[model samples]
Target: MKTFNVPIIYRSPLISAIKQQRKQQDKMKKDFTPTRLEFGPLTILLARHFGFCYGVENAIEIAFRTVEENEGKRIFLLSEMIHNPQVNSDLLSRGVRFLMDTSGKQLIPWESLQPEDIVIIPAFGTTLEIEARLESLGIAPLKYNTTCPFVERVWNKAEQIGGKDYTVIVHGKPKHEETRATFSHSRSHTPTIVVKDMEQTHRLAAYIREEAPAEGFYEEFKGQYSEGFDVTKHLGRVGVVNQTTMLASETQAIADYVRQAIQEHYQLPDDRIAERFADTRDTLCYATNDNQTAVTGMLNVEADLAIVVGGYNSSNTSHLVELCEEKLPTYFISSEEKLISPKELLHYDFHNHEELRSSGYLPQKENITLLLTSGASCPDAIVEAVIRKLAGFFGLEHLVDETAAAWA
Candidate 1:
């Protein structure tokens, strides 16, 4: 892991307690079972890895620096700086405005942008069209751009596959900015299409097998396919790529399904199929892989409930919630504010795309355990706040220091 110079804002008493807790946890490492700490009525089991990732940190650093350096100059973001609402809200508070929303809706008119204004591209890279527009305005996109290097790496892989005359089949949410940017970059070299999940991949496979009509492709794919893309021709020799934050297993499954479809259609075996399609491994960021893997490891514990903290619309955060929900009841919350009480909590339902309240969210058992994790863009401070809130509900606020000590 690369070392990040993030500031630690631990409250004094909490810091002391965390240090003590760390000592105890370190001492009991070998024979460690589920340790119970009383915080009023809540029991929390922190995941091994959670909170802000390197790419987010790097983006925040650059965004803040740009704000400080360009005082009195207008600053615009290509999109939400990162998925966390709090982070975007903080940037907005500092006079940074977004040109586009998460779904690629243009909130600020491009015609309004000036040559002197600074535009910071989000961690998710912008489409080539947006880059060109910014350049036309004399605003160098790369000057203040904060696109993650990992995302750029995926684009590079797409280019490499495209150069080999293979169509790029991207496994990601088609509406996502990263997917759009990647698709645009890939289309410069070869035909590209985006698949959101297994269902979409299945439809794509059917199309590849000539079971689906070519005219229906536009309606099914909508805005997902590259301009001038030919469904029949593009699906013949395709390579797989993915959004850097997509579920690792899902991406692999989609790739495998596509590969199989091509083989069957061409009457080719595994060795022959390799000549047409590139076997690219997952493009998920290390933070995403580590956090999701850590959540999986945490879920081995038979917890009564799980809490996944981050912006609801956050892709990587939603994936964490999905992973946790598979094993136990999971609450996808934005902050500690969502923890209303021991019996009630507010959470976002990814399936329905709505925020709903639930009762009996926290079990009242004395030894109840919770699997706690957060999205890549979430801050540890918010996680700490959640711990405090849970402890307060259980009337174990005094144990906060002790718990902090354990972690330290």
Candidate 2:
């Protein structure tokens, strides 16, 4: 794996040392166990895989390097460089403005951009229409494009199957930038439709099974299908791809469901199932899978609560919180600043899209055990700060430095 020249502010001496040691011990990355950190009373089980992934590091490196190399010139991002608040704020502080919000709403007019100005495509990429719009403005969209290779892999897979007349079934949040970009790319090659989850997939399968009227498909799947999509014509052959950040297991389940539907509809045998369903294997990135698996592994051990650190809007982070919530109480926070005191803390409820404060988050006990982890875009520095804050509450703050020094 290639590394990026990320800013030092995002780095953590303790985290780097721990990760290096873990990597040395498990070169194959077969272990999903958490790293145990003991501080007399409070013990933290840190997820084996968490924080800045390859795509995020690469995007940050490009954004920062572009700012340094092109001083005095305006640099505009298509949207946020990544989902992390700290990273986006850092870029904003460096005078890198955004032309649109994450939902594709225009913040700045396209006419304001000059031919000499630079526009950066974020890791989530952009829609084909936006790319053409930028081209018309004389700005090269791909020149500073930080689109992750794994995401492009999904697009390539879609195109490959689309060439063979397979209708692409995208598993993702429809309003997501990556999904919009992927839908645009796949629809250009063949018929494409976006399904958010198994519930929506069930609804889509009704049409595939011909149990529902094709005319009702338009009203049921409004804005989810590509232009000129005919459910009757396209549902015969299909393939599944995902947003790369969604739950990998969920994506696989949806694919399995769709394949089974196609099999039942066509009365195809196991060997002949491929005749109806294109075998588009899991499209999730390595980081999302590893992190989610690590959480599952961590849950095997008993714990009081789980603390997930990352931007609230981050899709990967919410899925991490979702996994933890199934097993135990989970708090999603962006930084240590959310720890208002030892007695109370502020946390984001992603389901409700609101922040709420709660008392007695920490269990009243002699010895405490908790789980801690972050998202792909979260900086290790934020995780370290969160650990230090918890340590201070237990009056074992010095032990954190000692542990880091020992790891160092």
Candidate 3:
């Protein structure tokens, strides 16, 4: 992992100290145990892996350097460079404008783009159609592009599998920027369809088994399938890929379900399973895997509650919240400011897509234990602030500095 020279404000002394100590102790980052930071009555258990990932750091470095170097020229991002609000707002404060929203809705008309204006592709990448449009505008999308290499690897994997005469089954949100780009690219080579989760994949299985009428496939899938995609023909032989941010277990379960569906439908033997279901590898992002796994490790310790910090709309963040909510009372908040008090907290429920206030979130016990972690895109400074806020409620703010000094 190469480090970046991001803004200092995003760095956290406490978190950095702990991370540095752990790196010195275990350079490979193979240890999945959570870091314990105890301050008398308050105990914070931090996940082993969290915060800005390699792709995010690379994107941030490129975006910031672009802004610093191209001073006076109009800068436009194809969409959000990343899911973090602070990062996007920093770019906006630096005079960078977004051309479109996450849903591909045009925020600025395409006709307004000038030849000299810099256009930055997001970390999730963009559709080939958008790339062609940029080329037509005489803008080199590649030069200013900050697409994550991990995402590009997914596109390459899809191409490789599609070349083997397999339909691509993308497990992701249909309208997500990453999935849309992947669907556009894979459909160009082979028939591709997007399935949001295990539910949709199960529904797709019915079509494969011929239990559902083929005529209704169009209505059932509607805009999810590729152009000219025939449900009867394309669902025969398939391979699965994902948005790289989905829950790893759910993605694996969907793959297993589809593979079994193919086996049962075609009556294929174990050795001949590849004929119907392409034996493809998992395409989840490394950060997603590590973070999810760290969440599992964090759950090993009994905590009163969990606080997950990230953008409410972030898929990866939402999955973390889901993992925490399964076993404990979890608070999904964008920042520490949402920690209104020890008794009450304001948090976002991604399932309902709303911000709600909760009472008696914190327990009345003298010694409080908490599990704290953030999404791949969240800054460590935000996480530090959250810890400080919680410490403030217990008058243990000094303990943070003491712990950092002792660790250092």
Model 1 lDDT vs. the true structure?
A: 0.83
Superposed by TM-score, candidate 1 places the C-alpha of residue 311 at a distance from the truth, in angstroms, of: 0.3
Which sequence of candidate numbers ranks them by TM-score, best first?
A: 2, 3, 1
In the order shown, the candidates' Cα RMSDs to the true structure are 3.5, 0.7, 1.1
In model 3, state the lDDT of residue 64. 93
- The candidate with the higher TM-score, 1 or 2, is 2
Error of 1 at 278 (Å): 0.5
Highest-TM-score candidate: 2
Tens-place lDDT per residue, model 1, 26-78, is 65333223334556445677765567777888898898888988999999998
Better of 1 and 3 by lDDT: 3
Ranking by lDDT: 2, 3, 1
> Tens digit of lDDT per residue, candidate 2, span 278-339?
99888999999999998999999999999999998899999999999998988999999999
Q: How much is 193 displaced in model 1, in angstroms?
A: 0.5
TM-score of 2: 0.99
Candidate with more favorable, higher lDDT: 1 or 2: 2
Q: Candidate 2 deviates by what RMSD? A: 0.7
TM-score of each: 0.91, 0.99, 0.98
In candidate 1, how many Å is residue 179 off?
A: 1.0
Q: What is the lDDT of residue 260 in candidate 1?
A: 90
lDDT at residue 1 of model 2 (Cα atoms): 86
